[model samples]
Target: MKRKRTISLNSSSITTRSKTRAAAAAAAAKFYLPDDCWESVFKFVINDKSKFKNRRYLNSLSLVSKQFLSITNSLNLSLTIYNGSRPFLRRLFQRFTNLTSLDLTWYDRDLNKLLCQISRFPLNLTTLTSLTCSRVDSLRSGDMCLIADCFPNLQLLDLSYCSYVSEEGILQVLRRCCKLRHLNLANCSKIELHGMNFEVPNLEVLNLSRTSVDDETLYMISQSCRGLLQLLLRSCYVTERGVNYVIENCTQLREINLRGCCKVHASFVASMLLSRPSLREIIVPSLRHFSVTEREFFKRHICLVY
Candidate 1:
């Protein structure tokens, strides 16, 4: 009743007549939209981190189609490395080639070797703009030099609370990072009391709080960093004379923190408020009282008196 059903007996065929009435079965594969759609989705996810943490979200997306993975990798511009993430640094660097900011605040490991590895990569000047290595116990002068050599174009560097860093280390940063706008050396007390003198014209915000920053260093800073917007000398041993030099030189200073300077007097601070119209905020020493005139003057000028 049925016509003859013939099958080819080609040896090259994966399935032959010997395997009768049988074939492999598979599920439907997932599909993806065009490149533009993937790009939009990647951007949305990268910006909306409420659903997934940054690295984890990216890692999950990378398991998708190749196009989606590529889009995610391209959209990732920042990375926060952990102490245990040292082994994967190379891979992370290779993937997030567009990183402009790196936060190493939590990483307390062998920073010298880590920096050496980062320097080897072909990262552009614009590849990294902001870097934070604050509170690093093992930071050294060589490490600071490595930072200058690796990311010379860094605009914001936070080296505050580091256990040890010599004047030479801080000096290297000021010299090599020509574009440095903000530098935090708070509590890096190991810096020499006299030798840290270098020019950083572009430096806008400098924190020398709780260090051995003497009047000479302060004067040198005033001369060098004239465009300073925020100068933090909290708990430093600087005097009214040194502070006077800063107020006179740094014409663009919007905020100054002089809290805890034993040598600075409130009368001098009152004079600063009266003289410097550009000041938006002033943090005077504790236990010092401001006169009614000083208070009224600061209020009149819209300057924050603390």
Candidate 2:
């Protein structure tokens, strides 16, 4: 009986020591790592290339601890709202205070109401750099002015397929948004540009595809936006002369889309391709005019997209 009791006491002492060690380890894990270190780790993990993986990892991390949840919320800078309501917009602004980019391309609602909500709220959106409201047909000149007022620090604005926004609205944007770099007015057929000496010096990428942008407008673009890198003039009214002028003046131009631009002939394109070594890609409608050797030569220097 004595021997058995001694053995039982020894087993109890071992069990108690094991439980104490485990409790100490749990405490260490809970308090050892600093918040900044954890923030860096979370940032690295959340910035994974695959969106699906990043979201999954973020969701799982948020459930790990309160610190993780706060970090996740603070680091989320980009947001895309498809069906945004006033209440929802308010909630989003409240939740993510550091939003730098917003995409409402898929938002199927009246922009006036949205703008009203923005105007009503004293939201700190100075950090916003990119805004895409593509296909929002109801956006008028007044709406563009409102956007300029709200997002003064905007660098990239995509108003593609918003046919209702005319030259008045576009000019308003160009005048106000001086920091604008990339502007996409693709398929805005009604934008009428006469003899206006507008200049967007910082403007780099412009898409006037399928618009009635003629040589005069092209000349204005060449003069104003000299630093233009990529220009898309597909299906535009610009002729070979305009194309040549742009090529000669806009020395920084790398890629130009001339697809469906029926007036832009092959000879001008070939001459520009030979003259401008800076030209990287020229997307045309056809390559039938070029001989096999000529085609090979052109291909070696630049990308000939059909």
Candidate 3:
């Protein structure tokens, strides 16, 4: 009887140990990794060559756990929307509340409706620093004013190819968004600088490429944006006199793109290279009478892209 009782006790102990081992294995299989670990993994996954595949992986990760959803939301800093609907935009803003940069280039939608929807979410626009709404042809002065009102802390604004935005709209942005560091008004034909007196002291990079900007506009930019470093005036109406004015006033200018400016002579660019040691790049159209030696010398010091 004693031997049988001892065998039963030993068998019960063995069964308990096996159950504990099984429970430990199950717990290990369901272990949740830390958020930082998942973020590191996400970074690795996004480094893949295929963007679609990366997006798929990100979507899957977001659906895995609440922690993943939060990480994905914070990591999504820049977004590009093409012809987006109001409801879709609202959902995006709701998910990515900390979005810093947004690009709506070539959005073929109602400008007023989109702006109205964006205005409804002031919190989303408050943290936004960079905004690119290129080729928004319907963007008028009033629309620009609305943008300035909503996004007062905008540091970089690219309204390129927005031909409808007039001088008044441009002035409104410069005046309101005082923290603007980069402003692109490329192909904005109606933008004029006849009576503009406002200053953009922090403006470092300005792009007026393919615009109707004349010497007067250049002069205004030189006077107002004294800290101008990179200036793109490609296909603009600026003459050598205007370029000279910029070189004289914007002493900190590093790069200038004068491509397709037929009136700007290559000799003037060579002179600028000699005078402005800070000038690292000067992209001009092919020179007609530029000597090989002079070209080589300019190439050695600066990137003279033709």
- For this target, which candidate reaches the highest TM-score against the unseen true structure? 2
| Residue range 1-306, candidate 3, lDDT tens digits | 999999999999999999999999999678967778878888986887665676677788899778888998866766777774456887788888777887878686877778777887745477889999998888877888888987889999999888787888778888999999999988887766665577789999999888888999888887888899999988888889889888888989999998889888877777787667778888874446568987797887765545
Position 195, candidate 2: lDDT? 42
Per residue, candidate 1 scores C-alpha lDDT tens digits across 1-306 of: 123223233443546543543432122223536777877767775786453376678788889778768777877777788988888888888887788889888988889998988888665546789999888888888999999998978999998899687678878888888999998889988654365466678989988899888888878887788899999989998889889888888899999998999898866766796667899988887756677877788788889887
| lDDT, candidates in the order shown | 0.81, 0.82, 0.82
Off by over 4 Å in 3: 1-32, 44-57, 82-84, 122-124, 287-289, 299-305
> Against the true structure, what is each candidate's TM-score?
0.79, 0.84, 0.83
Question: Candidate 2 at 46: error in angstroms?
Answer: 3.7
What clash count goes with each model?
0, 0, 0
Q: CA lDDT of 137 in candidate 3?
A: 82
RMSD (CA, Å), each prediction: 6.1, 4.4, 4.8
Return the candidate ranking by TM-score, descending.
2, 3, 1
- Candidate 1 vs candidate 3: which has greater lDDT? 3
Tell me how candidate 2 scores on lDDT. 0.82
